[model samples]
Target: MLVAGCSHFAGRRPLLGYSDKGVQHADTAIVACAEQLQYVCGITGVNQISTWEKFNGGKTPWVRVLPGRQVIRMTLSNSRQLNRQDVIIDNVQAGHVYRIDVGSSGTLLTATYTDLGKLDSYTIHMPRFPLEPKAITASF
Candidate 1:
């Protein structure tokens, strides 16, 4: 019952062009979603949710769960070659629908939960170039 999705950057564009900045926008979106989930749903403990960047050579950022368990680990790294597209990011959810966005520089991982037939969603924003834990804030 694991859900997953991913996206990546392709082709070249001017450094300051819109296409080049798509990654940044995608990162922002992910961060926004995570915040919404945390604040709106009161989800405190986020166990291991896989992020796409881990596919590359990087240390996945993990969250500590109840007692002492790191559940979610998201990793990101730069590509070795200019033409080589780095593994942007991935979203993995167990028994839930995971909506993910893999941008050039970041990843947006979201999970939709169903409890007693009630639907709930949670999200996290992960950077693809370097693993840094940013504060999750609500989008609304």
Candidate 2:
């Protein structure tokens, strides 16, 4: 199992009780990020993920993965910002591949599997903007 706590900044400086407000904001962000991560993992058929928050003069969010889990959690700090994060699993076994796409702001994720039920190379097509799509070939 894996568990991690989110970032927290406190006790640095207190200006008219603003530190408390800051802590609240940070806690909200951490919870939101954890929820997003769980949603993405769930889309990938991973159902043994959970997250919670701990407050002790600061805020920290933790994620827990159950036993025999093969999932990764992805957390985004700010949903208002537009960014791209991609991961390619190379040398994957010849079988059905899973893809999970999660985030706000209309982000898209694509995964392709080829050469199933045959002894041949598998080709994956992934779009990169309006230009030509990116091709990834894997042999087994």
Clash counts per candidate, in order, are: 11, 0
lDDT of each: 0.24, 0.26
Question: By TM-score, who's the top model here?
Answer: 2
Q: Write the per-residue lDDT of candidate 1 for residues 1-140, one digit (tens) a residue.
A: 11111211210111111123334322221111122312221111233233323232222222211222222223322242111122222332222222322234234323332221111333344432333433332221
Model 2 segments beyond 4 Å from truth?
Answer: 1-68, 75-79, 82-94, 103-122, 126-131
Q: lDDT (0-100) at residue 128 of candidate 1?
A: 27
Tens-place lDDT per residue, model 2, 77-112, is 342442333223233232222233444545543222
For candidate 1, what is the TM-score?
0.17
Whose lDDT is greatest here?
2
Model 2 lDDT, residue 121, Cα: 37
Per-candidate RMSD, Å: 17.3, 18.2
How many clashes does the backbone of model 2 have?
A: 0
